[model samples]
Target: MEIGNKEDNRGYWDIVWNPPGERTGIFDVIKGTEFRIIYHDESQAEVSFTRTWDPSLEGKAVPLNIDKRFIILRGSSGFYTYGIYEHKEGWPDFGLEETRVAFKLRKDKFHYMALADNRQRIMPMPDDRLPPRGQQLAYPEAVLLVDPINPDLRGEVDDKYQYSCEDQYNNVHGWVSFDPPIGFWQITPSDESRTGGPLKQNLTSHVGPTMLAMFLSAHYAGGDLSPKFTDGEYWKKVHGPVFMYLNSSWDGSDPTMLWEDAKVQMMIEKESWPYVFALSEDFQKTEQRGCVSGRLLVRDRYIDDQDLYASGAYVGLALPGEAGSWQRECKGYQFWCRADVDGSFYIRNIVTGNYNLYAWVPGFIGDYKLDATLTIASGDDIYLGDLVYEPPRDGPTIWEIGVPDRSAAEFYVPDPNPNYVNRLYIDHPDRFRQYGLWERYAELYPDGDLVYTIDQSDYSTDWFYAQVNRRTDQNTYQPTTWQIKFNLDSVSPNSTYKFRVALASSTLAELQVLSKERKKDLAFSYLHPSFFLSNVITGNSSCMINVLAQVFFNDQDKGVPHFTTGLIGRDNAIARHGIHGLYWLFNIDVGSAWLVQGLNTIYLKQARSTSPFQGLMYDYLRLEGPCGC
Candidate 1:
């Protein structure tokens, strides 16, 4: 059979994939089997199936058939094109060259089929109708468009509109556009007619740069829509749920200027984080004395009520004793402000000085003394109490107190006299003692004094026992003296001894004696002497002696029962008799020998009615053996 001219590519043909050197045609395999036919148009497409035994193809040898095929593909330029062809019965009689076979079985069957006809008139698919993939494939339908020309439906419409006279995409494309980019408005301070003008101006001036940057970021990321700007009514409606700025006026003037004004009026609502600052004295005035600083704890009613004063709050502090002057110090603390709710603030880490705390908010006035004088000592913490700001007539009352001024005291004691081998004496000057309330007096002496006396001798016995008394009476007693007596014969002539006397009272009393003796009979003694009366002595009172002593001797024989004795008798009775006088004899050496560790106890009991004057007095007496020559 003769095939069409190799260059005359003018008809559509079905594609078939065959293995190398295979003789079977694709129709032979599909003749007895069922096959599906698919057709696509620029706007819509469909797929159908027919069995070999179906009635439509009963008498026909080639059962497959497709009618009215149409496919339109669109180009970037606003135009559509299509490839047209008509299929005839029976396969074409042509030899299958490698090149021809390759072209007939291209991987993209749709493209191969379109190009086989050698016609550039391919139908262009409508922008809205064509699926993202091939025309014959199943896919979702295009979204509907909305018109934006109507003022009432500007934001309400689904499809964006534009001027059709300009670019076609500008009109047909579904995307919103703004004349001035988002965050294009410049805010400024407004006049008195604008209530929140000052604040709006401040916020815009302070934080506008940051907000502008964020808006620019959103624009760069292809945000869905431009940020909307509003003021007064518009602001209340659009950003009512959140915090936003209120433009002073919307007369279509300079957007930047209006934005600046709006920003000033814009607040973070009571629910946002607070901005706090510290207040102190004017720098110029405190330049020499050094600046005073403290923290401010601001609370916003909308954000948090429980932790309103917990850091980040507005606080004011005045120097110790000074409350009127206020200055800005640090940003370490912050607080939120709200019109409907009350707030508390705490100012801490205050300079080591005095200060008054105060707070001010819209429609409210508050002041308090942070009487907390911070001393900046090691680990010192100062709590300036909670400062609450309430509406007028409901705020807390102010209170104040004066810190007292006082000084410390000084005292001294004189040195001991070395030449006199006597007890140390202490004398505090009358002037120094006058501040007795804050002063303490004490006297120190060696540990071995025979007797000690206080100048106030007329005091009660209780005073004597307690050993401390106020010398109210200026009268000085000569016996306000401590005494120590040394009997040369009682100690070894050439032996040395050391002693210490403590002039102490019942409060602080101690006496220690140490000695070295070589005499055949040497004794160390302490005598507490008193007086006793005797009835047999005919109205006579004699001295009685009470003694504590230690006796030592080299020879064992000399350590006898009579080694030490205490004699007691009336002077008159002693004088009446000669060498053998009437007296009571107590042998301490005998009693000590019979007791363990040579310990002895003695008691002298006087009978009742023994004498008219039965009072007792004690005297000291001593005797010792001479040193062997």
Candidate 2:
């Protein structure tokens, strides 16, 4: 279907897909079966297109029905579109790897793409990615524009994945046409129907003069995020009602102003969520939705005796499962809100259902899950009084490193190699997204691993962002050990200590605790020095297994790890140039006998060394002395 002002060829945009080659099958195509008008009035109009699955074509086509809808209100500057995907109870089993709605703009007209204020730039033409002009890099998605129509982009890298952003900030992004001074924007009002949580990264606008409304994708989070149906299970979901907005300079203003205008329009759409104009019963109206409100307070006695307001806390309700299930939940809707300065939050327009309230406050180490399930009915305004979150803490803090904000952005990120730079992030805040930073770890520490002293070292400068493998030779990598040194004036032999660590991201990696009594000999505690665990959570479903990290004291093997993060996560945040993938917390108990009065050290080793990408990023680490010590 055509969109935008048809009279002006520059504004014309269409939904297009590549025709399947000879090897393509019927299931690959979204064949439209029927189209009909749902309603028509002076105020608004709605239409639906249904693609029903045929039993006769079961072996060849996907066993499902797909319904797509579009709506436009009078005097509106944009239109809304949504879709429904369903599979019958007796349908054949299949897996949905990826699904998204894409729009191809007029290539000649839209030359500049804007993802964020600092991320917007004139993009390379589609032809620039061709052989003679471009040279392929590690993957086909990445290419070096060796020779481009515009000499400025020459010697720069062009990768669509480089422009990915978290779902929280992916509100409005599109292309700006300079000739006629027009903009084509895609605006997502809410993420309730999305798969991963707020931090999940997905693609946005890229070259080819393209814009996308991502619904389900395996871009950052791998196979776990892909939904698979087995035994003909009945399933259905509403993808979106995202807005396609168009704007132009009315008084001969700069075309770039359209981006700011689109941002303002985005807020307007967000405020009008649960749009009342949709005719489908499946799309709930404002009256059919509910609101949840409460105040969140945190009590970490080590920080203060009185409860502190959990300001800027991320509070949300999702399908009840576990304390941190919200990040991996893909089947249902989620409603999230940020707590205000006084720790107050008001989550509105949530679809009626049973949910568990989940929250994580900045500067805290663990997640908080409400004890009771909340049930919301139509027009229900539920108020849960004061809720308190006591973060995981066992004693007074001896020392701590880094922040507990579920991100490794606070750590030191090295500059990218000059030969392989993106140029856009040379001095940008997101310098962590640069390509080939993993190899820098080996270069910075050619002879030994990282060593940090409690009072003398600064985490911002001394601590590396990720614990990557050290390249021994060409095509070979080996695990590395980092040391943390601390001192105590006196030690209580009968007390127990708490060693807490939080990881912001992990990928096919395992953490092992080793002890070194004299700094000369390597000693093992629980597992024998020759013992090894074969598999890890690789994020690839076909080849996944449980992985673990251990802890030790004074280079003494404590029989078993005080704690082990068995089979944690597979978010490949390191290679993606992201600060975090998934959040994980572990609290270990250390025997006081392992501590000496003067000098003590703890060694943390990442056991996985097969690939440069196998590593983990620490969010925060702390060692707490026993209470009343």
Candidate 3:
């Protein structure tokens, strides 16, 4: 078993797996571990290596039986690897921090790495990250290559985390050796076994000339994504069967075509899922799995009275939880598929289990959860006829800022600071992934926070991608508050209005609302009324009470907020260059008594300022008048 080096104190480009001594970081190698031939035939063969844990070595080794398997088929160029992890009910309690298989190619031969069509590049050598060649940045993981072996790469920043990709797009990526016209790729046909849903971001190929098949890690999402077993709980999971694919061009024409060919092979493997060749009964075959088919339709009266086809909707089955729990769920398997243009979807080969069907449309604001649980018995073809989803809508849209597509891509994403850039995303579609973008907020808004006025401001250019803290000095960060100004032609004192605010991401932050009267306590303008305050209805209802936006009142001064999303989210998407994290929606209600016929300004305050990284990315925001209006 090849284990990685210590967490830190290791060289920049050192071979992470097995440095000097046989010192494993988190997982310990089992004693008397042996490999056994499961099956051997002219057509195919299967082999297994067993590592059993000893309770006596509880503190030393992971209290779980790790079964690693390898399979090879006739006329196949590459092999398949998978692992079965099990922790019995009597096993001692422990935390599983990280587990993965890594491959480090010969640096001399493989120099080009491809994560995606647009993300591929000829990378700098690991030595380029060492002193005299590279300069370490804010974190050890980031190194600016001052002088690289490939002079073209000089001044470019090389960070493994920079290449991290979401699980959905992480199907095939690897290193290319132009010398031999060969390609080494890690192809994950499906991510049903990986944790944190399809949008979960994990490390892919990086600067060590390293390619990782990440089964579990705390890369983008923090410790919460890492599972901890307590009181000897029994847990078992099948991590992979991910294919290690290899291809070569004999003609020596276009060696990069190997990447294109690897992509073709990836589709071949995906279509051959639930392989019937495996010897282990734990590995279910096609006959043992079930299928789900359905047609989803959306009924948003504001858009159209008739049911609209849920085009390009992400529909999936996950361990039963709340509406949006799939993003944070890690313990169970999840099967996801996009709805067709006609809103029809077929989820096949689902392992027999009880799951809740969850979905979110591309242009929709809220999530859709089927009220019932689905039971997938072997060979069961379950058809959930026609399903209609009515998004969270209570009234007509008086004013809407951005699209509610669970992404901040529509907002203004500033260009990365000239000093620090990842050339790949400069004018690229993923411009939001540039480094130090959070700091740009402080530079752009040097004096005051962003103030967007409806009809006058364009979201694409006016609204910033994220609401990050304004760095006051070297280490001090001040909380930021954005204002949305809109004019109301009339006021209805007896009606209730809905304020819908959807956040694409947030990191350990508190979003608050102070009463208009108490706004002075924080920082307010005596000329304008703000927050959820009574008796000061000069017009515009700026102070509306939201579900997650904590509203402070006179009697509840410094007490519990009327509504508080206490320290929500830990995905750290901002620092990781992720466009969004776990989705959050806060629906607030404003009474007619708080409104006036004039210009209204609602102050959206992000009250957390401990770290500059703490922030929020708004997916969309809309103020809706009463149902009839």
Candidate 4:
């Protein structure tokens, strides 16, 4: 093993090893030595041990200098750097319900130590209070990171932090700050000095050695998570019309099209825009549409890659195994582009061959060019030269354009004369004394001006506007609660306003955003209190439940929900786009309370049991307030 010299706050890095004696009978620490961070190069995944570089022991394991280490890691800074690790011959003694799942990533993990602060997230030390990871920790395992000042940081960084220390068995116990801070990082892990010993074994004597130590650490998801069958047409005929050209400009005016010029304008309006859609075996209708282009020459700029302006960043385009990761950005096998402003990119069409480009620019880390590999043939142009990268030294001068331009800069700025209009608009029969500011959701509440639709609504195909409930005792998932009561006469009602509750949740539990004047959970705000205990899953093919369209209101409208890579599938479960399904996290303002002129009730607590195969649902909810919403 060799890796030496990188410290000086580049997140510590030095592996170099040579200890391996004992061959006559097999016992040099059971034939293993340890130093984890794997994905396959040896399989058996879990192995985050320690050998302590003795930064006095930045992470612990000093008795006899176990392997002499130095691994701090921040993670997938941009499509993994030095990934696929696994040196084991051994390393897994400590307590054991679970240990290295985070930083070791794979749940679509992307770095920031597996997505910022919580680093590779997975605290779960359970009632023992703490001491599952490598041992020795009585206090000090809370250390947050990433406030090197907060310039936006995606996933929204800026964690509150405590500076990582970990001892009484949570293990890490030294040298904090390895880049943390990302939305209040807090791993309390308090309470588990269990005298720093006991646990010797349990889970039924490690059930046959923890199922042979999780099949020698390869992790088998038999608990069910289905979605590894692939072949959508063989992945649209090998990543069809192959796209992915970050930093645009080979010609094709940046609309960020490596693939998906709006799914090729809906396959050119489903076959007809001058034809040309062959994904192989000829789905016929050809006229040619195969493009690809590039250019990301970052000359040499470091203050952390010019503080990660890293030239328009994010430019993936994989295809050839493992392409369904990180929440689902790898859906259908990778294809992300956006490196314009000079990084240059293009993709008129695709379906070529051989690819792996990768690029990312948050704190400037991996793949500016660390193995981009490419090749195209079909309709022309394949220039993928120029990918020079070299950014990392205490990174983060401040970056983050991610999350779709910070949610299109929130309304991309343009409120006009807005202070909140559209005061009241009713449909359906939501009961609110003659309310009808002019039917919008198509009509449902208390039937005021009539627009009807719930006599047994079933509308499908989704545009994110469900009202569908096929009532098999409900849960064919459609309608749960949709209402609007009034009394403040439209405006001026005790001031204080911030209602942005969109909607969704075909019953997982507790989603109250009540708003009465005197009683009824008084002006409450609850939402997801056991969404089926973190949504149960058990797939062999038929164990689906993935909800992420939040907006349960009541935190004073700092409003957050934004997800929209578009998803809400259901021909009968299992077929997603940006990751699993049910996507559409609308702008959640969902109201915050204060309207009190007369009668006001905005309650929505109904769903408890419904199971259209349990597809947890919700629909187009853009409720704004002020005049008559």
C-alpha RMSD by candidate, in order? 48.8, 6.5, 5.6, 24.0
Candidate 4 runs further than 4 Å off: 1-226, 229-333, 339-480, 484-606, 609-629
Local accuracy of candidate 1 as per-residue lDDT tens digits, 366-428: 222344543332233444444443221211111101110000011121232222111111242
Sort order, lDDT high to low? 3, 2, 4, 1
| Local distance difference test values of all predictions, in order | 0.20, 0.78, 0.78, 0.25
Give the higher-TM-score candidate: 1 or 4: 4
Candidate 2 Cα misplacement greater than 4 A, ranges: 1-29, 54-59, 515-568
Judged by lDDT relative to the true structure, which candidate is superior, 1 or 2?
2
Candidate 3 clashing pairs? 531-543, 539-596
| Per-model TM-score on C-alpha atoms | 0.14, 0.88, 0.90, 0.23
Off by over 4 Å in 1: 1-178, 185-324, 327-357, 361-369, 373-629
RMSD of 1: 48.8
Per residue, candidate 2 scores C-alpha lDDT tens digits across 559-618 of 543334443456777777788887777666666776667767766778778878889899
User: Which candidate leads in TM-score?
Assistant: 3
Model 1, residue 479: C-alpha shift (Å): 89
Residue 94 lDDT in candidate 4: 18
